[model samples]
Target: MNLPNILTLSRIVAIPVIIFLFLTGNPVAQWFAFALYVIAAITDFFDGALARRMNAVSPLGRMLDPIADKLLVGALLIAFAFAGSFTTGLTWAAIAIMMREIAVSGLREHLGSEGVTVHVTAIAKYKTMTQLIALGAMLVVPLVPGLELAAHGLVWLAAVLTVYTGVEYFMKAWPHLSGAKV
Candidate 1:
């Protein structure tokens, strides 16, 4: 495997390590979890860049990259909710984020099958950035004052962006869906 693929796979591998650390119930272990999450998130950025720069992009990397991201984000969100750390708003935010993820993934798959491609937009990148920061903040709750509230606010913001992006995608695919030229 290329370095980019290795990095992508590393992000997936980091998920279990993060969960184990979070389950340790040690405050220090939570910090370790945060560190691993940061590393994995960083890999998400570097992997794509490396793939492009090295001309090592592959179908497997394309498939694994997004899967790794969704798994990491979903695992952390569900873990937070299961740990009873989420406020009601945060819970709703998490639900919306997860729901949007499922919806967008399906839409993208259908569009891809139709040979309709939608490029990732700035808003989409922002959504991911906000999510990573917000989740990391939530992970270090005691360390960050009022982080639960802050993280929930961020999650809500991300959810809005996520929904908007999904809608944009659907709008882009609408022509093809309607049997019109894309």
Candidate 2:
């Protein structure tokens, strides 16, 4: 495996440790989780850049990159939800985000099988950025003053972007989504 793929795999390896740290309920553990998360998030950017710069992109990296991202983001969201980080009535926002992720993933897989490619959109990249920022803040909410509010705002913003991107992806792939392949 190349450096980029190794970095991607490292992210996948770090998810459970991050979740463990968050679950421990200690401030130090939370900080550790936050650090791990930030490192992982940074790797997401570098792996892609390195892959392109070094001409080392592979089908395996393409498949595992998103899986690693989903694992990291999904674990953080579920942990935060369990910790009651979301608003009283806004838990559905998290659910909506998760549902959209799964739907889009499934849609992408279905299309891939049909010889159709679904590319990442600029909006979706923004959604990822907001999501990582939101989740990072949420993970470290106790460490910073007034950050919980900011974290919630980021989450809401990410949700809006997520929904919009989901719609955009659906519309773009609607032609392929139809027919017996769907």
What C-alpha lDDT values do all the predictions have?
0.85, 0.88
Error of 2 at 154 (Å): 0.3
Q: What would the per-residue lDDT of candidate 2 be over residues 60-145, giving only the tens digit for each residue?
A: 89999988888888888898878877776447778778888888899899989989899999889989989999899888887888
Query: Model 1 off-target regions past 4 Å?
Result: none
| Per-prediction TM-score to the true structure, in the order listed | 0.93, 0.95
Candidate 1 residues 30-107, lDDT tens each?
889989989999999999999999999999999898889889989999998888878787788888889888888898
Which residue pairs overlap in candidate 2's backbone?
A: none
RMSD of 2: 1.9
The number of the candidate with the highest lDDT is 2
